[model samples]
Target: MDEFLKWYFSHNPVAAASLGAEGYDHTLGDLTASGWQTREREQVQWLDRLSAAEAPSLDDAIDRDLVLSQLRGSIALASWPEWRRDPAVYLSTIFAAMYTPFQRRLKPEAELVESALSRLAEVPGVLAACRANLDPDLAAPLLVTRGLGQARTGRNLLTRTIPAMVEDAELRARLAEAAEPAARAFDDLVAFLEGFECGGTWRMGEKLYSTLLREREMLGYGAAELHAKGQAAWSELDARMRAVAVGVNGGDDWRAAMESLMDDHPPTLADMRAEYEAETRRAREFVRERDLVTFADGEECEVLPSAEYTRPVLAVAHYLAPPPLSASRRGIFFVPYTPDDFTPEQVRQRLRTNSRAQMPSIAVHEAYPGHHWHLSYMAGNPRTVRKVFRTPYFTEGWALYVEKLLHEQGYFDTPATELAHLDCRIFRAARIVVDTALHCEDMTVEEAETFMSTKASLSPGTAQGEVSRYCAWPTQAPSYLTGAIEIDRIRESFQGTPKEFHDRIAGSGGLPLGLAEQVALA
Candidate 1:
């Protein structure tokens, strides 16, 4: 296991850096054809080795299964044309490679600065590899469009956000010097993408999509069944949201109530961040007072503005978990403020979606007892495989589950806040419908956007961005509600208090729902 992990981290340095593995901070992964071939071959060998070995204990068995699932998922998708089609794959890798060192302060400033410089020097080569690997004839039009936007954002991150993050004058100067050429590499990528005649599709279709859910996520349901389930869940949540809306505003129109709530947001982005920080603190205290779950020693979370590159997809807010292997377990809850370049109407729409009534639920979901809290416990687990491999089925499901848990405990007891919380769930249910439809049910990108806009009640721009993300990442959108439902089932069979249940499930790490069920039942 140790040998395989060392090889894994060396080839996938960005993932290694994210996991807090040392010795990969200054490097980026190889994105060329040879790199992929080597990784695929090694993964198959490791899978075979692990499969032939007998487990010494339940923990060993679980770890062995976890690694096997990851390896199988990788091997299953090895034939997919992502490297040859998706420009975002390479661009996202470059951004994450440069961004991770800046996000985590585990290393000294000087060392981190040097690491950034080293990664900066590799930007051109990585982009060159991208140019070599990508076939314009196979490129997905939507992905190429999104990739261009990401390239622009990467340029902004290198020139603006990152340089300002360095505190020391000399280090800032050194960073700026290295960042200049890196920014130009992004410009070159933008130029290449602009000149391409990309007309490929993004759909994974029924077979590969079902394989992802079954083999990778370890789910029993196929794409069609999951789509039906999503439809049913969305209908149920819609009814509940309408009933709650009637109580909040003396009407059964949930959309009107949501709009009213949106009008109650902070007047400015700075104020929004302040409110989120305060709400995060309050949620933490409530969890401690209620003894909701155990917080790992030194677990801390800070609310901050989102980086420029992330603002496109993560429009409202998202969480970044701490490196499980690092001493610092502080997470970051990022709120993406409306970009200055947006039209006046766009700014209003963005702020409205991130309204004041929704702040408590958002805080709980992304911080306190949501991602930060859950991931902190996962980070403290002794098993390295558990720490390294995370399925969205468990992680996203746990985050969504806590939202309801807190609401049931009277944390979001007010009518408006309760409605806001339900709104969040409704959105997740809608994700199931859209995600399956887009990849498996032949739903067009435009149709998915409209479903989100009308059915989910998202703004058109937000809906468009959300649909694009679903196109890029199949099977993840439905994980929020699907995981929550699975967790609820596990809780029903468990003979323990809420804290024990929460801790047991979370401490099991982000396993597939099937494994998580085993842990919970045990």
Candidate 2:
């Protein structure tokens, strides 16, 4: 059963084609295709069968708890296809998500080009659905254009790349065959984008925005709620952050204090690596010392570089969680080096270029006692179902929470590092504001970008890209803050109860949040 789940989840055509899976994307492009539909139906059937079999086999309460957690997760994916959007949007999203990760390990002979080109030809049909579902309104075209831009993203990555790489002859030959098909797809995508007319006068009506909000809240919560809580938490956290800097900055204004403290003890890229290593060692101690976690000896990870294209869009550092089934796939952390043409001091000040303030905090969030630790446990959990239905909100929330946990445990004793911690919180708060103001509030693209830049101190391009993402996809970003806070609240609620949130949630077998239906649902 575990083998089945692993095989199903890991064979993502998006990942496969992007990495050179020939015809893989084409085979899966028609999500309603017979084979795809059959496999989905069978997956649902297997859950029922597994539930009966796994339930009786549990020998103890803990074993039962683990099994149920996994089961709930599996059921969620099998049931919740509504989260999936139209083809152009989905493909572009696939391209965006995959572009950065694969550039680092992409091969010339890979089948990705073959699969992507074949699927590229299918973009027209996918857009047809968007047109049908959204027409009778002018805003439909803008939405359609946004959808098409996404597919073009994948088409562009494949068309502009793969051929010139001096790596794989066979792949190059295969990629050549895909050239025409890829070009055609690119044209279709461009035509869609060209027809877009929403321009500056565009506004997603309040009712439309509300509909988006409801569907979004289905995955997570509202921004106004998160924003209110974040403002309050920000004040509470600012005090703690300042205290962490008291030795050097005299416990004054945290932002100023951080700058004063960081003015000294500057670290190079190499120093950042060393800091990361030291923190990894301490993370292991934090887990074992407090008996807070159980880490696998078999599971370990190494930090690597962010793929060039996608690296620009993400934080300076990010973690790649391993598949639950692949024992060999270690959890990975990528710390990127900035492209040349900038001064070293300026680079270090940029979060993407600086590893000094980022490496430790990132490792805490992305690796040890963070995403890797939790995910590996989820993977290894006896409840195979819980392992499959991962919620980004739940997973990211836990990771961000663990980051704060480790910092407070005295891992970040320095004022400079402590300031970085608050900066992270600020980043999430900004996400709350950006995500809500753009989608529900219907702020223009430029207005949303300014909100992040002026308040969060984010770069314009970074802010704009993030706003585009929030507008296109609602409620997903706020999960970083909303999900984390929910975890904290649940943990607090459970403090006096017989079972902890950790235990209750884990015991519930990591069921998809959707399946609870609601605590009082009749």
Candidate 3:
């Protein structure tokens, strides 16, 4: 297991660095076609070795199964042609390679600077590999457009964000010096993608989507069953949201109520950040007073404005988990308020998405007793595999689950807040349907955007951003509800209090839903 893990981390260096593994911070993994083929062949050998090995205990058995599942999923998806079809694979890798070291700041100042410089030097080669590997004629048009935007963002990160983040005069100077070539590399990528013709479809289709659910996620059902489940969930949540909206607004028109709530937002982006910070503190205090779960020692979270580079796709907000193996466990919750470049109407729409009524639920979901809290527990897990291996099924599901848990605990102070929580839930439920239909059924990207806007009641801008994410990332959108349902089911069968159940499940780290059930119910 140790040997295999070492090989795995070395081949997936960006993931390794994100998980706080050393010796990989300065390097991106091999991005060439041959490197991918080599890794695929090596994964088969490891799978055989793992299958042949005996687990000495329950933890060992679980760890082995976790590793095996990941290997099998990777092997299954290897033939999907993402390397040729998706340019974001390389672009995202570049972003993470630069962003992780800067964001984590776990190492010393000089060491961090050195690592950044080394990674910046390697950027041109990685982009070269991307150009060599990606087939423009086979590229998905939607992804191509998205990738072009991300490449521009990458340039902004290199030329602007990182320099501004550095306070040391010498280090800032060093970064600015090295960042020039890397920014140019991004410019090259942007030009390449701009000239390329893209005519491919983004859908993974039913067969691969099924493999994602069953093989990758270890779910019991296939896409059809999951889609049906999503449809049912959406119907129930919609009815509940309407009922809640009637109580809040004296009418059953939930869309009107939701829109009204949007108007009650902070006047400025700085004010929005302040509101989120306060709400996060309030949610944490409530959880502590209620004794909902155990908080890890030295765990900390910061609420901040989303980086300019991330606002393009991140839409409203996102949470960045701390590296599990690092000395610091300070997570960041980023609120993406409208940037200065946005039009007046675009700003209004973006602010509406981050309204005051929504802030409490967003804080609860992204901060207290949600991702920041749940992931802090995950970071403390003594097992390396448990720390590094995460499925969105568990992580996102736990986040979504805690939103309801807090509501039950009377965290929401008003009918408006309650409606906001339900609105968030319904959005996740809608995600299940949209994600399934977009990949498995005949839902176009435009159609998915419309479903999100009309059915989920998201702003048109937010809806477009959400649909783009679903297209780029299949199987992930459904994990929020799927994992929550599994967790809720486990809770029903557990012989303990809510706090005890929460502690046990979250402390076990981000296991797959199936394995999470086994551990939580043990």
RMSD of 2: 7.3
lDDT of 1 by residue, 366-398 (tens): 997999998887898998878889999888898
Candidate 2 overall lDDT versus native: 0.53
Candidate 1 collision pairs: none
Report the C-alpha lDDT of model 3 over 161-186, residue by residue, as the tens digit: 88777779889899988999989998
**Better model by TM-score, 2 or 3?**
3
lDDT of each: 0.86, 0.53, 0.87
Worst 10 residues of 2 by lDDT: 513-522
CA lDDT, candidate 2, residue 401: 75
TM-score quality measure for candidate 1: 0.98
lDDT of 2 by residue, 1-522 (tens): 555544454445554443322334454344334434466666566556655654344323233333344444434433323213233444444453334323434333354455445554554454444333332333434345455544454444555554554256766666655655655655665675566444231333344433333342343434455556656665666566657556556765555554544444325555555566566666767666866665665777666555444433443566666555344336667664443433665455554324355456667787777777777666665554554455566677777877777776777666666667666776677677666666555466778788766545355555665666565555556667666666665565344332234434533333334332221121
In order of listing, the candidates' clash counts read 0, 17, 0
TM-score of candidate 3 on Cα atoms, chains taken together: 0.98
lDDT of 3: 0.87
Q: List the residue pairs that clash in candidate 3.
A: none
Candidate 2 local Cα displacement, residue 167, angstroms: 5.9
